[model samples]
Target: MRQKARDLFEKLGYRKIMMAGMLLTGIILYGFLLDSVQSDTYDIQLFQLSQETIRSEKTVEDPVKTELERQRLTEEVAPSYQFMSEIVDNQTALVASIFGYILEVKAPPEQEEDRLTKEEMIEKLREDLRLLETSDNGLRLTDDMLSSLLSLSEARLLNVQKELNNLLESSLNESIRVEEVARYRTEIEQEIRRNETIPNDIIQAAVTIGRFGIIANEVVNEELTAKQVEQIRNSVEPTRILQGQVLVQEGQVIDREVYRQLELAGMTEERLNYKPLLGLFIFVIIAVGLLFIVISRSKKDDEHKITEMLVVMVATSISLILMKLLSAISNNFDLVISFFFPTALAGMLVCLLVNERAAVYVTIFVSAAAGLMLPSGYSATLQVDVAFYILFGGLTAIYLIDRVGGRGRLLHISLAVAFANALFVAFYLLLGQTQYSWSEIAFYFSAAVVSGLLSGALAIGFLPFFESAFGMLSTMRLIELSNPNHPLLKKILMETPGTYHHSLMVANLADASCEAIGANGLLARVGCYYHDIGKTKYPQFFIENQVNIENPHDRLPPEKSRDIILAHGIQGAQMLKKHKMPKEIIDVAAQHHGTSLLKFFYYKAKETNPDVDENTYRYEGPKPQTKEIAIISIADSLEAAVRSMKEPTSEKIKKLVDSIVEDKLKDGQFEECDISLKELKKVKEVMCDTLNGIFHSRIEYPKETN
Candidate 1:
């Protein structure tokens, strides 16, 4: 059944399969967001009697009441005051200086000049006081008050100035409004009256002058007042509805606040509120569109493109479904289990199966989907916070797991992800200014820790299913196949030890070349290990497995020898298929030799017969179809040629490796693959370096001492 499905998928092609997968993902997400159990705004009416008792499913603060209380608290805060003592001092100085100037003009030095008449002097005093009044000094004095001050004699005026300065100094000590200035002036007059040393006339003059100078020095501090109001608002606690608390009882009339709460809880009615669902649909469209664009732009073969899209879509769907399931659990059990959802599972799996950049996109999509799947009572911004939590957890997992080479490293990655999860949760709590108790903090922290660990656990658990179902060549899977204890590897080790050693050398050479050319070294190495498995069937016939015996090919005809040599590629591929190895490994076994002619056998057969079919001496070849396989082919031939060298030198190794690669290039052995000339050059350089190291001249040990 699976094979039939795979054939159908192949026929449909990658684009069609991608479209189908996206469509299915959208349907599943839509179903999860708008489940049958959820209510819509159109289902319930305003001011209606409740038919059923409604209770708070989760502990949530009523934003409306909370805001109202905050506003009330802010309004109740008093305006702030700022003291300006300099105003009092400056005004007193101006009053004293004005009086002193008047006294000086009235009594000039006795013999200095001709004395002015009383009317002229009074006019001059009025003019001078007018100048003082109209000047930039902030004083509000009447002309009559200035005249009253000018009428006083020097002793009385001095007494009045002294009394007024003292009054103004004490009165303008604190912040006073414009309305309170008159009150302080009256208080100053009372203080003057309480002192009998000054006459009533002088006292009246002092009070009038002091009143004019006592301007409203203390004013409202706008900035400080605003800050105080904001602080008060912040201090107001949010009104909360505890879980399972009754909102409206059966037969109870729903008020405006109750109706709002019902709407917030998504319990109002079943009428379509297409806004959220529409938003979700648009989100899915954008996400899937971006994913499609990214996948389309990626450089991969048709089969790989199909497999990658399938894995991404399936992994994303599983993540969203998990979020929905956890959301449902949270709602049904009245628990905040969404925080514990293994949000990073899909992203980690994607990273393992695909690349990190694709995994990053998957993380973004899954995070947004998880946000949409949160409880309806959550505000839009809180939902965004939930998205952030999932994103951080998933990204942390991907970064920590990207370099992971074996399954044993998953535990360390899981612990790191858990730490990241906990850190994000702590940051969220701090950013939100949530007032959680120690126990509550511990609970959430533990949930985050569990979420991280479970993400890794779930990723590890689901990886095999994706790899097997999609035939993905993951590093972990390759590492497992590279193990020498595997059945096929063990068979080759015991049956044909020479061939095993040759395979090991080929694996090392292929791995190095692949790495040098930025290809899949692990896949190349593993493929090399199994590439020559067919040699095990007729170990003695193969030159490597002769074990010091006479050459078996010497007794056979050149045509039979060519057949035996060509059969290994096909037989090895068949044997790999029988054992259910990945197709990539099987291709290496089959196509490594390509269609290159067997020069030795073809030339040998032509020596005896005038007409020999050259095609019969060629390999049954599909050619190397990928960079890894192409490198394997070169590495396999290069290793065999170099190993057979007598007293191989660095220059000889380099020449031989270059010659073999150039021949393959000229013969079109690499034509079907994407290996470039630049990569080929790099492969040759790496081969020469590796072969030189392997077959380097060793110093002769001191045999005489032994």
Candidate 2:
């Protein structure tokens, strides 16, 4: 049952379930912002006293007032008109057609011998006028007017036509509008009536025909007037309610403009609004995408960091919960408490334990999350200033923390973060419109400084627990363990000086190779210091510690020598585990040798016995499972191999390092670890250079001492 639980625990590492919890955690994180993002609801109606100060959350145009302005401007514009000269021509043509038909009946131009009688003439005129009325030329003359024109002597008829033409021409001089059409027609009737030269029947006939020909000279241009009204509409700018504009101050009555602005800004929206939920989903998706990109870039690393990544979620949650709590407290008490939020805390932790890339991702997420909260001043919730401040400050901490040496560096990191935070706040002040007194300004900068300092202090306090809980080692911890005076190092040195010196040489080789391949060099160096601790128990038997003494291994059987040599891996692991060392370091000690063959012992045993089991000559092993340990394994073997050489040169060192790495490749030693061929190639190059430096030829020195 215990083994089963261990299997289950190891199964849940970060890279094992990267996608499984990302969306769920992201959604949970989004839930924390829903209430903060939602616009505040109010009990006060129009004309009521305000319970608190309320500001607009966004800018919006006033549609009703805008429409009213457009209507008033449209009325003030003068109507347009166009001179339709075609109307005058059409009316004049109709009058001419009427008189021409009357002349044809009264006296035919042919003057036939059987001349038509007056009754015949009148009847003929009427028939022709009826035909004319049905055609395009409109006939306007009445029956009385037609009969009178037929009865007129030839002289009187000519005079009446001349008088009507003059009167029609005079009326057109003014280019009559529709309103003047009636008066013009009446004046035409009076002109004929005043003529005593014409008979009463003629006057009546002229007046009837004149009224029919009268029409308005000009018409309204609908298209032009419409375009003018549109221009007026466009010219009127809309009245807007700007974001963060104070809608109603505390205890002020909700007047017309105030209430209208509140409604426009959505502060008066219904209680169960979906906008907040929609916004939360979008923001959560963005945060999830950021983390997904970060972890997805290194699949091998993420698989092992599962439980450690969950701790990342815990760190993020603390930041989110604290920011929300502080924002609420600040809102309630009218204090700028958000200035005291240690926004960089999560970023520092992620950069230290995981990586800078993942820390940067957390920085962006936290920055955005900080903005989507009930802001400090009862103003806009999603403050751009707040988001940018946290963003730059957190990123600053992440990069700086990468160079941290030990706990002593925490103070410098704190000062740097505090200065960064204060600088950002000052930047916001220069650009923002809000007025702040020097005392308030001092308070704000002080809070920001405290915020920065708190980030460093909290990270130090939380780091140990994270390291222990995750079974991981931080760089600071590695540095502390690497000290020459460490109890473990001193014990190994005094008990077995040869083994200690060999351990230090292996540490130098492994650290350089690990760094060349972007692995943990500090951990590799520290792991090397403890890798051979088991050699202390049987110091004289090991060749390194045997010094000039007689070889104990020469008398022992091949199997016994092999057994004693293999015991160190197991014993060193047990010793480190007893001391509660990091699992990573314990793994380096336990798995560095990795089931390799003891060829000399195996061959000697084979010569003595015909059929000996070769398995007994091999170390019982679990192979290196990480890049750092895998590098150390190669360094350990290569360091020992080169140290045993009679005369090492640069070419010989390179050749031997390549040979060992190639043998490890063929022996499948790197199969269990995630080290790639490319990285392994780089590791060999760095090791060869380090080995050449250690074994380089020197010039012969004179006997100056004598």
Candidate 3:
């Protein structure tokens, strides 16, 4: 049954599987995030004119209106207060501390050699007050408050403290709420003036100190306030509409009270809200439709890489999940925290692992979904600014990752992204009509920088996981394989030193040519390094590795020699597959020769017997199945053919490269791949330039005259 199922899956083809995948993606999106992306379906809102009259189905408590009434009652109830005797005591101590400081400044100790200056005393007193701010006394005195108190005579300062203490005892015996502190302060000033024994010189200063010391000691009693609220909520009966109540007449405006009644009676147009459900359907269609078009039009090579589709689908799902999580966080903060989302992570992953061009379109689909995950509930209107910001940032990431060369250049890419993200955020914030506070502007700016850095960090972090799980070949993986120390690369260098240098030359040629025609140059370069791995097993048999030895093939029949040459291509493929190398590298190794006639051995065989067949002297090949391999095939032959030339010149090399390309074209080696004639022309030009440079002649030193 399992084998049958696997066979059926293949028979259904990529198009059908893609359709099913798209459908599943849509369903998952709708199932999880429908509330965020659904539209304003019913068109019902407060204060709108009703086009049709709505009647109550049955009489019930109008919860909306009743709740409003209860809230009004709760608001009207004055907050109860509790006067604390301990607050009065603390204030008395703090006031006493101020007078003590004043008396100490008035008369320093006789035993001290140096008397403290008034300025120093005042400074000390000020520092003491600041320290007191942290204590239970919670006293905070200003410079004016401290200096004025210290300026008074020691005797007068003591009298002022006594007066303040008595006044607090008399006044705070009653309640003093924050709102009525002013009224009580005025009464205390009158009481102080009536005391004739107190000197008049410090009266104004004492009044200032008295007023400064006073605070609202009677704090609100939360227990009493909550009890009062509960009573109001319980006492207020729910408002009700009659069974036959006309909640709204035709063309009647939905005022607050009338709208509440209509809503309570389930007569609002949203009672049967189907538009959100329908909107979800349309939303899914648009998102999935974009993916379908993008994947369908990609390189023909992608049709076989079904894993690429699955990887992209999973990446898309991850992006949606990130948006949903960000929405949840944003709702809590009531801020658009999506500004900090790592929008470029998915784009960078797809660009490196899959097609860079397709990554841009996939990102657009993700960004469109991002706009749907808005702050507003369920009536999702796409936030044009957010969508635009995400789309541009994602596109920038794809461009940088695709075009930029070295790992060291990544920091430069991150900095570039940071600048773009910050600029985009600032531009949008400034351009919008709503006046955002400087703090809000700072928040968004910081989030943008963080967003850019996070994209790089997250892309780096998740790259290894995705590559391991999917066994996908990325540019980084290709670079790693290109290292000289890799076991397979070292094997060729040790066992087949001549073939190793030949492979390196082919790599240089293939890299330049593939890049000229907008193909994956890195893949071609790395593939070329391992393309001749089988020659390691029979290093001495091939001409390039025949150092200081007689040609072994000279001792064998032409038929036997052809078989040895033919076995190398097949053996290299098996060896690479055994080492678990990427399929793309294996393809290049297996198809670089492309079943072309082996003229050297075939002509030699033809001299011996007229009946010798041409088919017997060819490499068994699947042909070049991609542009990279096709270019490699051409470069492989061109490098060998040019190296064998005697006293090669630039003009001779160009003609030679052109002839090699035409020979491959005539033999139909490129028929299985998608390489075009125009691209081939560019490839020929690149090969000619590279070959000429490699074989350029230099002026010889004047023959050792000594």
RMSD to the hidden true structure, all candidates: 10.0, 4.8, 25.3
lDDT of 1 by residue, 1-706 (tens): 4578679877997778778877876776567655522332334467888887777654667888899999888878888877777897788888887787679767855775668665666667666667666765434444555555567788887877787777777887766787787787788778878877666655555665666777778678999999998888888888887755677888888888888887666666655656666766776678778887777866677667777888888898788677767775775754366788886888888888877778999998888777767653433323677788889988988887756657767878888888888898889779865478887788889989899889878887898898888878776678779888799999999988988999999999999999886678888999999999998878888888887799989999998998888899999999999999998899999999998889999999999996998888889899899999999889889888987889999989888988999899888999899989999889888888888888889999876763
Best candidate per TM-score, number?
2
How good is model 1 by TM-score?
Answer: 0.67
Which candidate's lDDT is highest? 2
Model 1 segments more than 4 A misplaced: 1-253, 256-278, 380-382, 402-409, 423-446, 697-706
Cα distance off (Å), candidate 3, residue 472: 4.2
How would you encode candidate 2's per-residue C-alpha lDDT over 1-706 as one tens digit per residue?
4355357657775544667768667877877877777767676688899988887776779887888889999999987988876776666666777777777776665657868887777777778678656754255666666777888877777787777777777787567888888898898888879977768877878887777677777778899999999999999999777777788899998898788778777777576767667877887887877777676664446544565466678778878888877876774554466778886898988877777788888888888888876375444457777788788889888878757667768778888889999998898777779898898888889988998999988988988988866665776678778888889889999999988999999999999998888888888999999999988879898878877799998899988899898899999999999888888888989999887888888999999996999888877778888888889888888888888998999888889988999988888888998999999989988998888888889989988885
TM-score of 3: 0.60
Ranked by lDDT, top first:
2, 1, 3
lDDT of 3 by residue, 1-706 (tens): 4355447567997768777877887888787667664322234568888777665645669777788899999999998888787878877787798777667666866877677876888787766666666654355565666666777777777777898888877787778888888888888878778777556755665676566567778999999999999998999988888655677787888898886666665555544557657877887788778767766766645453455666687787788888878887774785578788876878888877888766887788778778777442222556677887788888888888755554445555666677788889988888878788888888899988888888877777777777777667787678778889899999999999999999999999999998898888999999999999999888999888989999999999998889999999899999999998987899888999998999999999999898988888888998898999999998888888887899999999988988888898999999998999999999999988998899999888887776
Please, what's the RMSD in Å of model 1?
A: 10.0
Candidates in order, TM-scores: namely 0.67, 0.83, 0.60
